[model samples]
Target: MMLIPTEKRLDADTPPEKRGQMRDGVRLLTYWSDSGRIVHGGFFQLAHQLEAGDVLVFNNSRTIPAELKTVDGIRVRLSREVEDGTWDGLILGESSKKLEFMHGLKALVTGPGTEPPLVRLVFSCSSSRLLRELYRQGDVIRYEHVARSWPLQDYQTVYASIPGSVEMPSAGRAFTWRMLAHLQKHGIRLAFVTLHAGLSYYGDDKWPNPALHPEAFSIEDEQAAIINDAKANGGRVIAVGTTVVRALETASDGNTIIPQAGVTSLYLSRTSKLTAVDGLLTGFHEQEASHIDLLQTFAGEEGVKAIYKEAVAKRYLWHEFGDMNLLMRQERS
Candidate 1:
C-alpha cells in the first residue's frame, strides 16, 4: 500500500484529531489503468505515459471573486444567488439582533450570493465597494474557516475562467500547459466544456452536507462534435474533472449528446449511470461528499479501495492542490 503524505492512517489506533485531519483528504496516489489492468506509480508520470488516440476533456469554468471580510464587527461574504440579485449575506452575528446601521439594508456579506440584483448586505454601508476592491487586486480573495483565512486562488483551478464560481473545480490545477503539450506531441487531443463551479458551501463544515447547489453552463457545438468524433473513432474520452463529467453526462441522452446551455442541480454518485464520458481525471474527494461516490462508480469499489489504501500508505497530500487519479473505462462487459 502506497501511503499519501497527507493522510493519517486509522487502523483501529488513530486519534480523533488525526482522523478528522485524515478523512478523505488522501492524495498523491498514482496508477496506470487500462480496461483490465491497474499499476501504481507517483502522479508525475502521466505526461510521459499516455499515447495517441486519447482525448482529454477539460472544464473551463472559472472561480468567482469571493471573499469573506469583516465590517463593523460583522462577518460577511460575497456570492451570486438567484432571482436577479447578488447576496452579501451575514455569516456571524446574532440572528435576532436586527443588524444596526444598515440603512434599511444589510451591509455585511455572508454565505456567498448571486452576482447582481442589488446586493443584500448587513450593517450600514454606503455601497458594495469593498467587494469590488477585492476583485481589483488580481482576483485574490479570502474566506474564513473556523479561524483560518484560506486564499481564494487556493480554491481555484489553473484554467478557471468566468468570475462567478464561489469555490473551484480542482482536478485540472495539477495539469500544466507543459502537460498539455506533452500529450499533443504524443498525438493526444483535447476538448473543453464550461460548468461554472458552485460556491464553497458544498464543502463548508457549516453545511457539511453536499448542498443542492445549482450550476451554470455553456457548451459549444464544436466541443460536442469533437467528443463525438473521438468516441466514434474508438479513441479514449477522458473527463478532466468531475465538473466536466457532470456537464457531459447531464447533456447526454445515453446514445447522443446535444449542445446544452442552462443551469442544473445535477448530483452524481456511483449509482448514476454514465452516458458520454468513458474515463475520468480527478482529485481526491472528501469522505462522504458526492464526488467520492461518483468516483467510486468509475473506479469500481474494490479498485477504489485498493488505490486509496495504496495512496494513503504512500503518504499523499490532500485537498484541492493534492494528487489525482485516472479511472479508465471497462471496454468489455
Candidate 2:
C-alpha cells in the first residue's frame, strides 16, 4: 500500500473517471487495533467514520492559469503564478538568470510561451477572465513542457469553488459529489472558504522570505459564521485540505475563531498551535515540502511518521492527482 511508487497507482484497478475517487479508490487511515496502531482502509468507509453533525470546511479556492516561459530557450519552470500577469519564474538555467529576470521585464510571450525556457508573461490586463472561460468551455489550461503544451484538468480539485489558486489544493480532490451528498444527508453540513494557494515552488529548499510570496488570500463573513456555529454546537469542524487549515488557523484568535477577511502570511510550523480544525483531510505531500512539518503539529512526530510510512507503503500517487490521508480526532482511550 506504499504511496511513493515511481509509477502511478491511482489507476491500478480503476477506470478513467473512477481513478482517485473516494468510493472507488482512496487510501484511508484508521486505528486498526486497541494498541493505537493506525492502518489503511478503503475510502468508502470514511463517511461511516464520521458522525452526523460534523461540519466539513472545504477550501473551494479555484486554480488559475500558471506557467513558465523564457527567452533563451532554457528551462525556467513557473511555480508561483504571482498576480494577474506575473509569475515567480524558476530559472533552471541558473540562479543568475533568476536574479537577471528583472532585466527582461519587457520580453513578452508572443504565441503562448512554451515550457523548458519558462517564458513568463506580464499581462497588461486581467486575464483571469480567460481562465474562467477555459473552465466554462471545459478546456484545460495549456502549459508548455518542452516543445508541446500540456493541458490540465488535474489542477481542478473536486471541491473547487472560488477561483484563485495557482495550483489545486488537492487534499480534498477524492471527495465525490455522492460522498458529499451522503455527508449532507446524514446531517453533516458543509461550507466553503477561500484561501487561494500561492506558488509552492520555493518549498523548504530556499531560505525563508515571506515577502517573496506575492500572493495571500481572504475569507468571507458567512463562511466564518458557519464554521464558528459548527464549533459552538459541539459539531466536529473538519478541514478538507492543508490550505483550509492555514486559512482557518490564520483567522483564529487562539480563543475564538473570527470572521476574518485579510491576507495571511502566517506560516504554521511544527510548533504552531492549531485551534479551529477537529479533523484534517489532506494528501501525501512530498518530504521536501514544509507541509510535512506543518502536519507534525496535527499529529505528533510518531503519528506523522506512521501515516507517512503507510502512504509510502500503500502506493498512493503523489501530487495533485493522488490519494489522500484523513487524520481523525485522537482522544485518550
Most TM-score-accurate candidate: 2
Expressed as tens digits, the lDDT of each residue in 194-302 for candidate 1 is 8766544422343322334567776789988888888787777788887788788888888656898887667776687887887887765445556666776687566
Once fitted onto the true fold, the runs of candidate 1 whose alpha carbons sit more than 4 angstroms away are 1-37, 42-44, 78-80, 87-156, 200-211, 331-333
Q: What's the lDDT for residue 66 in model 2?
A: 45
What's the TM for model 2?
A: 0.74
Give each prediction's root-mean-square deviation over alpha carbons: 7.4, 6.5
Measured with C-alpha atoms, the lDDT of residue 292 in candidate 1 is 65
Whole-model alpha-carbon lDDT for candidate 2: 0.59
Evaluated against the true structure, the overall lDDT of model 1 is 0.58
Compared with the true structure, what per-residue lDDT tens digits does model 2 show for residues 1-333? 222444433322222254434433666676321244665677656776677777888888777654323344444434444456665444444433232221233324433222323346554334464344334432223222112333455556677877667677767666778877877888888978878675564322442233334345566788778878888887877788877887788888775567766666667767877888877887665554367666766776667767766666666555555566777656332
